[model samples]
Structure formats: structure tokens, C-alpha cells
Target: MSEARAARPWLALLAGAGYGLFYLYAIGDVTLYGPPHWGAYLTEVSLERIFTARSTLMFEAIAVIELGWVVWLFSPLNLFLALILAGLLAANMHGVLYIRAHPKQCQVGGNKAFIGALPALFAGGACCAPSLILLLGIPGLGAFGALFGWLLPISIVVLGINRIWQHGHGAPSMLEYARQRFGLNNPSTA
Candidate 1:
């Protein structure tokens, strides 16, 4: 894989973690319980009237109103969260395609970094903190979501760098590097 493609997953994961931090702080408490409250800044005469206007198009109304609502709230946290989520979804899609393309390779390491993202994302959520603490039986763990947030990305980054280095030193690629690193280099019996 090209360096850019190799780096894409790591970059997306880190970006998601950063946006998760934003979600944990400024906007998380207020942004998600329901639709944003209508603002006088958006409506022509009144907030309710703007939403009730006859000019609102069926197909475009949701998009326009949502955008207006976010802008009316005047916080970029939602946009940051949205973009980060899009990046993560794209990365996971790429990983899925990679797995489909490389059937001969062992499945264990192929998309593990991608898989690690699920828990990493869970730790990002405010509500998941308690579950993580409960499951691990650590009292203060819930308060460290931000720290746990970077763990997956950082581990992926280290592994990616190691793979790139291995490839540079004449190992074939990350798959080959993983096989060797994990002593899975034996020929496949299948």
C-alpha cells in the first residue's frame, strides 16, 4: 500500500478521538437529547414560523433546517463530530474491502486495527464510561475516557510504523510483517 493509504486509518482514528474529546466536553451534554431548539436568529419573523414556511422543500428541508439549526446554535462541535464520524466510516469500509481482497492472508491481523476502533469509540462516549469502569472493576477508570480514547489509535500508529519500517527493510508488507512478528510464517496448510 502507498504511504498515504497506510496512514489513512491511523489518521482517521486519531481525528475521531479528538472529535470525541470535543463531544465529551462542550457539546456532548446538550447536542443529542433531541433536535436543536429553534432560534430567533434563523426565523424571519419568529423561530416557529421559519420552520412552518410553505417554501420549505420536502427533499431539501431536512438538510437545510439541520444546517440552519447547527449554525444557529453557533457551535462547530457538531460539524467536527460529523466529519470525524464520516472519516471513521470510510476507514472501516476500506478495511472491509481490504479483507475481501486478501482472502489468502490470515484474517487475525488483517483488520484488527479497524476492529480496535469499536471499543475505542465506545470509550469516547460519556455513557460508556461507567460500563468500562464496571467491566474492568476499576473505580477511577471511568474518568479516564480521554486517555483510553487514544490507546487504539496510538497502538495502531505504532504497529503501522513498524510495518512500514519492516517493509522498508525488505519485508513484503504489513501482512507479511505480522505473520513474521506473530510467528505465523508457516506455510498455510489450506
Candidate 2:
């Protein structure tokens, strides 16, 4: 393969490995903190009811799905995974936004990953709001929770659109230092 072609696979592998590390870290944090037990969110409900083993199992299953997507980032299937991953990222963002909105409720320490993962958690929440509503029995909370659940996706979509507008138009131009650091320029050209 040409050098550029060869580099693609290695770059993909690095991206996958990075995502996997991020996933593991996020799951570990959630397990350690037991899912943000403050406010009127579904997380609070889950904690209040002491989510059944089945519910916990389902949650773990979702985490595994996310991990799979992260791993797939190394493969040619990354394009497909990127869309879903973006939604997950958005959900994380939503979580962060929630925490920011309710500063008194956040229990996160100074962990950099925790700070970074907040936005992702929010984005993930937005992406999965419908499922969350169904699983949590949204109707039981009457109109308020139902309205919140219904609005979640719209918010996420808007956030995504804004992000795309802000960052999607540019093509990368490598600086000499960046080319050296990432080994990204064409060897023959150099």
C-alpha cells in the first residue's frame, strides 16, 4: 500500500483505541458514582427503586454497544459508527449541561475525563431519551416528565446542527510541526 493508505489504518486504530479508553473511563465513573443521584432525572428514579438486576443488565448492555462502536472505529465501518457515536457524544453533552444548570447537584471531582464526559453524557441522554422515557414509565410522572422527554431529542438535534455549522466547513492544512508529530505528510513529497 502507499504510505498515505498505510497511515489511514494506523490513524483509525489510534482513534478506536482512544474511544475505547474513553468508554471504559466513562463506565467506570458511572459505576463508581452510581449515576448522578440528584434532581428529578430518570437516574434519580433508578436509584430510588434500586434498579432491578434486569435494568442494570440492560444498562450494561447499552454500554457494551457503545464500546463496540468505539472498537469499530478502527475498522472500515467507522463512518457508520460515527453518526451513532455523535449522538452518544451529544447525550454526554446533555448530562454536562444538566450538571451545569444544576451546579448544586454535580458531584464530579477534578477528573479531566469527567469534565469532558459531561457533554457526552448529555448528548447520549438526548439520543436515548425516548427509550429512557419508555423504560422509566414517563406517563407516570404526568405531563411534566413527558414533556421533558419529548423535548430532549429536539434539543440534541439543535446542538448537533450548531456544532456542524461551527466546525464542518474547514479542510485541515498541516503545519510542519504537526506533519512531523503525526507523520501525516507524503513521504515522497517531503
Candidate 3:
């Protein structure tokens, strides 16, 4: 592969990492305290709590790392979940980038990749819903708790299904399907 082609995968990986970090921050696993102070670091790990679940799929943080002004509550299970979601997102992003680079050849619009991205974004929201629901004073606490707990898992399943579906359909097939669904006039068929 050429230099540009080689860089695309790396770029996608970076995007995934950025999103994973954002998810961690949103869920209160990672936090910022103040300006960075070089050479300041402290960490604590509780092996006993490594596999504990705080709520539904949410796991307890078995480790804590304090680096200068940043604090991270590390949970292996949660990190694994984040990585899975991020990897799917990165794969979709790579598809989007590839489509953008060779639009004429791909034929399919980049919107499908954008649609694939929605699940991960929505999954991130699931992480923050609990705090938001409490602050908003929602009356149906129990029902909301049950619903919110499953949102992340549901999003993961959706993303997995989308990945399989996208892989099974080639660009031309997807393009034709999009045209049919949206009533776009395909030159060949016209």
C-alpha cells in the first residue's frame, strides 16, 4: 500500500482511541483535576473487585491511577467493552475513509458508515444516563434504571449486526439498495 493508504488505518485507530477516552470520561472512569504536573503519579489496585459489577454491565473499578492532574478508575471489563465498541467504530471509520478516497469506485455514499457510527455514540449516552436521570428528577426511577442498564448492551448488539450486514453487502449492492430506498434515479437503470 502507498503512504496515504497506510496512514488511513492509523488514523482510524486514533479516532477509536479518542472515542474510547471520551467514553471513559463520560462514564466517570477518567477525570481531570488540574494543570499537569510532570513526574507526579500514584496508583492503587484492588484485585478482589476486578470482576465485580456495579450495575448491570457496568463493572467496578479495580484500579486507580493518579497522574499529575488526571485520575483514572480502571476497570478491566469496562475497558474491554470500550475497546470492542471503539474497534467497531474504527472499522466503520476506515470504510468511510476508503469510500471518500475512492468515491467513484465505492459508489456507495459515506452516509451508511455514518449510520453505523450512531450505535457507538448512543452507547456513550447510556453511560451518562444514570447521572442525568437523577439530576432531572425522573419519577420512574426503577423503570429507567432497567432500561438504561440494557442500552449499552443493545447498542453493542446493533453495532455487531451492522458490521456483519455491511461486510455481507458489497458497495454496488449497498448503492443499489440505497437508490431503491431513497428513489434515486440510477443512470444505468434509467
Candidate that would win on lDDT: 3
What's every prediction's RMSD, in angstroms? Answer: 14.8, 16.0, 10.1
Candidate 3 Cα errors over 4 Å, as ranges: 1-7, 35-48, 123-125, 131-143, 169-190
lDDT of each: 0.41, 0.37, 0.66
Question: What 10-residue stretch in candidate 2 is worst by lDDT?
Answer: 68-77
Query: TM-score per candidate, in order?
Result: 0.32, 0.28, 0.68
Highest TM-score among the candidates is held by which one?
A: 3
**Candidate 2, residues 32-147: lDDT per residue as tens digits?**
33333333212223342333222222122211122311321122122233344444344333333333333333443224324555453455445344445566786754444345
- Model 2 ranges off by over 4 Å: 1-110, 141-181, 186-190
Q: Please give the range of 10 consecutive residues that has the lowest summed lDDT in model 1.
A: 55-64
Question: Candidate 1 or 3, higher TM-score?
Answer: 3
Q: Model 1 over residues 1-190: C-alpha lDDT tens digits? A: 6534543445545655555444433332223334555443332344444344221110111222333334223223334444544344334433433443443452434455346445434433433343346667986665675555454344344434433432333334434434544568557742
